[model samples]
Target: MDAFTTAWAGLTGWIFETLVQPAFYALGLMDWAEDAYDWLDFGLYGLLTIAIVYLVCRPLEAWRPVEPVADRRAIRTDMVYTFLARLGVLPLLAFVLLASLQTRWEGWLTEEGLLPPTLEEIFPPLRAAPLLAFLVYVVVLDFGEYWRHRAQHGLRWWWALHAIHHAQRQMTFWTDDRNHILDDVLAALWFGGIALLIGVPPGQFPFILLVLRLAESMSHANVRLSYGRLGERLVVSPRFHRLHHGELSAGAAGKNYAVLLPVWDWIFGTADWNRDAYPRTGAPGTEEAMATGGWVRQQWAGFRRVALALAGRG
Candidate 1:
């Protein structure tokens, strides 16, 4: 593990210096070097996650696919989403927009003598065991995600935005990131706010993202697999999450709201233990265009739906 860590650091540093740093330097943005470096690492890790998910899930799908590839085009659209997200295109924009606002917010808070509280400050023992502290943060963040997911399903306007993700009947690993851009923004704000509140260390963010995203992708995979009854309770399995995306689970009627841990769903009475079932995916009563439309069409549809819903005409 030590050797692997050293090698990974060396490679990440080399790539950032050779490619990312030089571009920033040339553009007179060296003042933002530190943040850019982190973004670079985020992109690299995201790409690597995509590769790893593909390596692991693709074979499983081929071997024991629940359904055949009847809609290659739909899967291809999801691939576009994976690239847009895992490549950090949208995140880069969000970072730029959020960074200034965050700076101002923190500055104003500092002026008012009310600095944000960190988990470490609240629980000093966590500072001594960084790993345990990180795990604690992970649990807290996952808890936030579980509720955010419930809100996505519970709130009518939010459901209009999130319906894009559930509209994919041909679910695959790529489907995990196939959300409406507005939905993604809302999600980003939701979690980003929680992270700031708890003062999640910037250093620990990428690793947390990688772990959560990998589990999420795996949960969406088309593979006919489970982690056994007990194991399924510990971590979300494909069967566990597929039920959340199943036809009957659409809108406020959803279940299995956990992302990484099933405990949330279990606690909230949202978990369905019918592990043997893998029902057909996609939102019932949604337009067919939402299920198989191109990226632009789907995003536009989500926005339009939200607008109509908000206007009391949906």
Candidate 2:
């Protein structure tokens, strides 16, 4: 891992200096160099994650695909979402907003001279073990993700936006990030707030994010595979998550909401332990445009649905 990271750092540095730095220098935006570097790190990680996922899951899909890729166009659309999301256009917007949006979001308690303590403050032992602390932060953030995914289903308006994600009938590894823009912002706030509360460093944010994202992409892969009984219970399996995206399992009646761990679903009565089930993926009662449309069309459709849901007219 050390050797690999060193090599990766060299590669990323070269790319940034050769392309990114010169562009910033030309534009006289040297002041944004640090943020630009961070953005570059994000882009590098995103590319790595995509390549890794493709290398690992693409073959599995070919070997034991549960469903055939009869709709290449839909998969292509998801690929665009994945690239746009991770390349830092939409996600960068969310990262920049996190500080201002969550500065004092503890509500009246913040006004009452009470504030939340970081995990390190609560458990001083964590300070000495930064790696362990980061893992703990990952666990905490994953727990928060479990609930945020629930809210995406349980809340009508949120689900209106989240429905764009489930509308992918031709779900693939690329489909993990096929979300509405508003839904993406909400996810950023949910994830960023949890990160801040747990005292995760901005530097370590991408690491945990990479782990979760890899798991998510694997889960959504077309592979017809499971991690055995105990392993499935311990961590989310493709079979476990495919059930969550099953035709009948979407919306408020969703199941298997855990992002990284299946334990949350097991504990919360949302787990479907039938290891043999791999029903077709997609949401019901949605227009075809959302499932098959271009990125902008889907975003517009999601906004309209959210407005309708909010108005109690859906």
Candidate 3:
């Protein structure tokens, strides 16, 4: 892990110095250098994640697809969402906004001589076992994600934005990132806030994110596969999550809200353990534009829906 981290740092630093730093220099944005560096790191990791997800998921999708590739255009639009959300403007903006806030908050707490609470601090034994500490952080963050997903469905206005994700009839690995920008922002806040509260170490943040994202991507893959009865209860399977996206399972009626672990859903009574069910996936009653339109159209439709929902006219 240390070797990999070192190599990743070296590559990111070289890219920043060679390309990004010079571009920032020309734009007279040297003041934003620190944040820009972090953004670059995130973008690089996003690129790596995309490649890995594609290589791992594409074959499974081809092997046992639940649905045929009928709408190439919709899949392409999802790819646009994947690229934009992962490695484009979103990363830069999220880093600039959230990183600064974290820095100021942590600095303030430090000058007051107060340490932020962490799992290690809560359980001293974990402090000596870095791997166990990392796993605990993963579980904690995933628990937070499970609740956030439930809220997205339970809340009317949030569902207005989240509907864009479920609107896809052609769900693929790329579909994992098909979310409204506002929805994405709320998710980022929900995730980053949990990390802050638990005091997840800075170094562990990237790997934790990578693990969760890979699991999500695989869960969204258009594959006819399951982890069997007992295995399905352990980790989320494609069959399990496909049921969550089934046409009948949208909005507040949805099940299988867990991101990585099905245990959360099992414990919370949201688990659907029917391993043979790979029902058709889509959000019924979604706007046509949101279901099949291009990137800008989907975003606009989601925005319009949320606006109406907020106004109580949806």
Best by TM-score: 1
1 or 3, which is superior by lDDT? 3
TM-score of each: 0.94, 0.91, 0.92
TM-score of 2: 0.91
Model 3 earns a TM-score of 0.92
Single out the weakest 10-residue window by summed lDDT for candidate 2: 99-108
Which 10 consecutive residues of model 1 have the lowest summed lDDT?
Answer: 202-211
Candidate topping lDDT: 3
lDDT of 3 by residue, 37-105 (tens): 877887788899899889889999999999899999999999998999878587566655777878888
The full ranking of all candidates by lDDT, starting with the best, is 3, 1, 2
Candidate 2, residue 137: how far the Cα is off, in Å = 0.9
Steric clash pairs (candidate 2): none
| True-vs-predicted CA distance for residue 230, candidate 3, Å | 2.3
lDDT of 1 at 203: 61
- Misplaced by over 4 Å in model 2 are 1-3, 25-28, 100-116, 204-209
Mind giving the per-residue lDDT tens digits that candidate 2 earns over 19-112?
9999999999998887888889888888888887788889989999999889999999999998998787998889778756666565655898
